[model samples]
Target chain A: DAGITQSPRHKVTETGTPVTLRCHQTENHRYMYWYRQDPGHGLRLIHYSYGVKDTDKGEVSDGYSVSRSKTEDFLLTLESATSSQTSVYFCAISDPGLAGGETQYFGPGTRLLVL
Target chain B: EDQVTQSPEALRLQEGESSSLNCSYTVSGLRGLFWYRQDPGKGPEFLFTLYSAGEEKEKERLKATLTKKESFLHITAPKPEDSATYLCAVGEGGGGNKLTFGTGTQLKVEL
Candidate 1:
């Protein structure tokens, strides 16, 4: 739960359009991540932010970019939407300083559809 | 590169039936192994994080055990509510924060 929420719970856009998904966390955790889940591919990280204004790419960051200007917010942007990019996106915050470190708490997810 | 594989792709269990889901992983270094439960149309919910071999964690009717090469999520007496996709992921600590995940095991429990 981690007090996380993602905006635009469901969206449909045409190919080549730019899309952005927002991930907000109230836990104020230092680490936040964006991941996409698809059939056969499970979940693949798109990007992550270790601190405000510090972002890094993940395994499948080719078509996506991210920004984190504040501690509680991380945004993932798809430069150009493609049918192949259509998938369920999830937001997660790492529970650092806890007994179970590196364990991520995920949001409800946003379903994006590209036509 | 690290790799994860979950077996039985899908499983069907009746109420009160007990079973186990397997997650096999190969990483350069094992930092933490995590288990998650995801329902349809929702993101994965964290369940357990095992740090080393022989370590185990439990929550109600679910128990997770980790070994050198694999982890097992055991269900002691599942109910219809227990039906969901179980996910396994592993981290190679100190290298990066990305956790490689398996495709997951879809479980269906019927009454």
Candidate 2:
């Protein structure tokens, strides 16, 4: 909830459709991450960006892709949505250079439902 | 692989009741352990970070303690407003900032 904001807080999509979620941050932190939260599975990281255009996959990267064109924006794309991908998505920001930067601050989160 | 496990998936307590939540972890290097409180429909808020065994941190009504294999979140004289899901996560050294999290424990407090 720091300065992070995720767009399309709630969305309902159909299977096989492409879905994109946006994360915007005003904090301009050096790191950004995308994670999905589901019942019983806890929160799994999808991808992360250390800097603009420098991205890497995470624990649950399959079926999900991420792009960061600007320092303040990170986007998560579900190439072909599936019911299994339906979950609450959250974006987080951090900057290790700052004190307590090891702690990640999260966005409000975006809830997606795939049918 | 780094793994975390939390006990008592759900717990119900009366106002002013004191209790403890447990989080156990298995990870190499054990960089840090974190505790977070999350309300329904909201992102998790950071609570405490324990860097080594025997270290303890405290807030108004919550206290977090760390051990070699696990961490404990102790709530003393809890209030109804303290109801929420408590999440535990661990970061391993040289793990590139990735954290392994537990499923979390849901707490419900009634007046």
Candidate 3:
């Protein structure tokens, strides 16, 4: 366990309902990311935070929002869950380094089903 | 646009068999290439990071090598426990912590 954890290992929600997933890291990494894994698509980034209150959109950020209020916690919120949003979500954290590419440690992942 | 592509999509190997998975990438400036192993229903586990061409890294029965345009994850005498989806990601300079990932190659090992 390299200090990354995601809440609600599994979830089922109705379409149009608001839902939020939480990612917590004990490592205090500078970068945190949220990604969704679908059938044919690889893990596509949804949102990421470089620091507290500093976030940016990823390739697939529509309908999703992320907030990082503290160093260890990053929250991803779906304003209105859709059936197309049913997928496994993953959280990852990476340390800052000169390598320009620090290795990311991932959480167990959350399986979400929109019915 | 930065992109990564993994080959075969899926591979089946008997226990103790050796094989390699390929990852081809196109980026503006390559900063690093990473390899990860993911079990079903779990997040990806970091395996290795290759920062430059001609770089190679190894751990246990897995060896990762990188070149200017692609990378490879080579498994030597793989075991049943080595069965998992092997993912490859590329990080580009100036991308600001963004990583582009490939679809991944799912490896199955049977005893």
Candidate 4:
């Protein structure tokens, strides 16, 4: 569906360790986003990139960082993983220039666990 | 602050049962309202987008309607395959493609 795929569908890491999740898209959309889903807290935006080398913080950007060096790849990194950071992370892409383009399609998602 | 609240955190219905899920929101300037269906272990899939009040969109057994303060997702004769979590989100003016989401309503269709 949107040619979006997230690597490391499931992962387990200990606290204070470094972890990075990857999102790859084939549609070459102008925008890509990262979100985390938790029990009782729905999905919250983590970060997003509009284009190569352009990125912005989201509602829950603390403890996380992202980089976009190419149109097809977006990466999210946790500086030091924490138990509280364990959750399902999702990648979404959208193209505002197309018809009904505001709609964001999502990737399969990555489940991360911090021990 | 833009906020969205979905009612009845969870619902269970027998096959062919009709029901409706509610989504209420408050935003400074409403740009768009979106509905998505998320299956277990998967990401959300776009369902509908309502730009203004008094608008309605439908696909198969699902119909989405929007008003000034709320939106409703109505299901007609749902099948077991219809079981999934429904999410509602709102895009506010000047938000720059960002959306505020509700917790979502989980629906389970039984035989």
Q: Candidate 1 has which clashing residue pairs, if any?
A: none
Write down the TM-score of model 3's second chain. 0.97
Weakest 10 consecutive residues of candidate 3 chain A by summed lDDT: A95-104
Error of 4 at A30 (Å): 0.4
- Once model 3 is optimally superposed onto the true structure by TM-score, how far is the C-alpha of residue A66 displaced, in angstroms? 1.1
What ordering of candidates by TM-score runs from best to worst? 4, 2, 1, 3
Model 4 Cα displacement at B73 (Å)?
0.2
Question: What lDDT score belongs to each candidate, Candidate 1 first?
Answer: 0.92, 0.93, 0.91, 0.95
Best by DockQ: 1
Q: Model 4 in CAPRI terms: which quality?
A: high
All candidates in order of DockQ, best leading: 1, 4, 2, 3
Worst 10 residues of 2 chain A by lDDT: A96-105
Which stretches of candidate 1 lie above 4 Å from their native place? none
Of 1 and 2, the candidate ahead on DockQ is 1
Task: Summarize candidate 2's per-residue lDDT along B1-105 as a digit string, tens digits.
Answer: 899999989999999999999999999888789999999999999999898999999999999999999999999999999999999999877745878899999
List ranges where model 2 is wrong by over 4 Å.
none
Q: For candidate 1 chain B, which ten residues in a row score worst on lDDT?
A: B90-99
Interface RMSD of each: 1.1, 0.9, 1.5, 0.8
Tens digits of per-residue lDDT for model 1 on B1-111? 899999989999999999999999999888799999999988898899999999999999999999999999999889999999999999886634679999999999999
